[model samples]
Target: MTASAEPTPDDVVSAAKALHALTAIPDHSPRWSNTAEPTQWTATHTIEHISDALLFYSGQVARRADAKLPVLRDGRDAPVSEHLDNVLSSAHVLAALLRDLAEERAFHPSGSADAPGWAGMAVTEILVHGTDAARALGVGLILPENVCARTVSRVFPWIDLTLARPPELLLAITGRFSIDGVHSDPDWWWQSAPLVEWDGLPRRRDVKPGWT
Candidate 1:
């Protein structure tokens, strides 16, 4: 099934509310380590990243039926508190937007040559990044079974699992690890490989990259 048959605006709002509740819990773990340069985002950093991303996408939804939103910059150098605040504020904006758009027009991330919507992108973000943030907090995220299945089906073909990496890891990289094997892969090698390099691994070309 296509994204048009997926969740509605009210559904997105409900999902966002559930995610907000998940992020509200206290995370006592040491902030994420910036070991991975460039995207040196730790667990908390990932949470902030997702929050920021949601805001960016949601803003586009609000500005116009087709507004090109700005990409997120590396905020690693920013003060931790400031970053955290930005994340929280962004998340709030996202949640509010979702609520406001209940059952409105459907968003399509893969925009027409001109404007793109955030529907599919939002679901992928909430499921994957939401799981990442929960993992950092030592909590387990129980996503809706249908959502998981749909996301997996949509993201599965886009990934190259045969590139010296576990199918699960590849799925995670492409945001499809909703079923089993999400955390089963001890080493996340797919994350280390260049996206282009994995083109020869497996899967068909019709499969689109879930995230850019």
Candidate 2:
């Protein structure tokens, strides 16, 4: 968290590349038995999920000018190398798209108000999910507190950032913890998209409908 403000498009792309490099390291040989933190997915499965998520995010930005979001598919049955490559490629493409259309407003199910906000969500995904994969691999990776803080400020503005460290705060707002007797569950949602009359309010999509 070394950044001072919302991360630029370039920062998002750079962080994603760094994450890919971390997950691409060859020494995590025994992670086959390790389960990712707070999830049933294994280390390998988590990495693949990260890549698949990047594609999903990419589709969100790619269709910024369209009324509907593109349907993205899972990265199933793919090897580690292939997953890493897809993540790297998708990150770059999404970053470039955001940079080029920085001012464009998009309709995201997550409710992003602008193109850059969607990019912020992508950055959050990299830092948070990257940590998930790394922890499962028994490694430590710290995203800059500033970047993490900026993401919280942008997407989850209702979160009380002063109450915890950047990483902990990020996890807390994302429903990774139950603070002060408040339980995290499907009702807990991030402010991914912007508010609109038709949308009612910005909320996480239902898991029953392929939200995972």
Candidate 3:
């Protein structure tokens, strides 16, 4: 998990828009189905997966902030443009919900999270999967570095930022492979819970709960 400043809805909103512009270019649009290296999912599949995740998270946080809501899972065969639309739409809704009540905890399999934790997860999905989609499309995903840095600090407090920057860490977060100078630990897992709750460990997913 990347850890920093609680990711604002604005940070994710901006990154999704940037990805939209990058993929909208004629040269990149045609490669939507191409393989995104280091991951088997196609560009379209990766984006669709991100959309599903954001929508799922939004529902969780919204429920925590107010009423009970069921999450929606859209079909994957939709056009690439519609997929991007869903990504942006989900980001907007999640961001808005988090704007005022970022501190509220929501249910998560990994751990319950407040607004910052949710927002950090949202941005990480947008930027990291954005990297996957962009790589498959033959373009680079450029978002706010400061925002990414803040995100890394907040969600991945266990990492020493000096070893690598947020960009590399984002890609390696999945522990698929190394990029630039960063590598993933298959044992590594996201710290979906609040940073203040971290125990200064790597949050290894391989470890069972209640294990000291």
Window of ten residues with lowest summed lDDT in model 2: 193-202
Residue-level lDDT for 94 in candidate 2: 80
In Å, residue 76's CA in model 3 sits off its true spot by 7.0
Candidate whose TM-score is highest: 3
Instruction: For model 1, name the residue pairs that clash.
Output: 32-42
Per-model lDDT: 0.45, 0.64, 0.71
Task: Give the Cα-based TM-score of candidate 1 against the true structure.
Answer: 0.50
Worst 10 residues of 1 by lDDT: 186-195
Q: Per-residue lDDT tens digits of candidate 2, residues 28-129?
A: 477744787777777777667766666776676677645545555663576566676777787888878778776676665555447547766777677777
Q: What tens digits encode model 1's per-residue C-alpha lDDT throughout 1-212?
A: 22223333333344444455454554443534422122244665665666666676666656544435566656566554455455455545654565565434323343321111233345555656656655555556665544433333333424433332332343355444543434323222221112233344333234343232
Q: Which candidate is the best by lDDT?
A: 3
Candidate 2 has a TM-score of: 0.77
Candidate 3 accuracy as TM-score: 0.82
Model 2 residue runs over 4 Å out of place are 1-4, 18-21, 24-28, 65-78, 177-186, 194-211
Stretches off by above 4 angstroms in model 3 are: 1-4, 25-30, 65-70, 176-183, 206-212
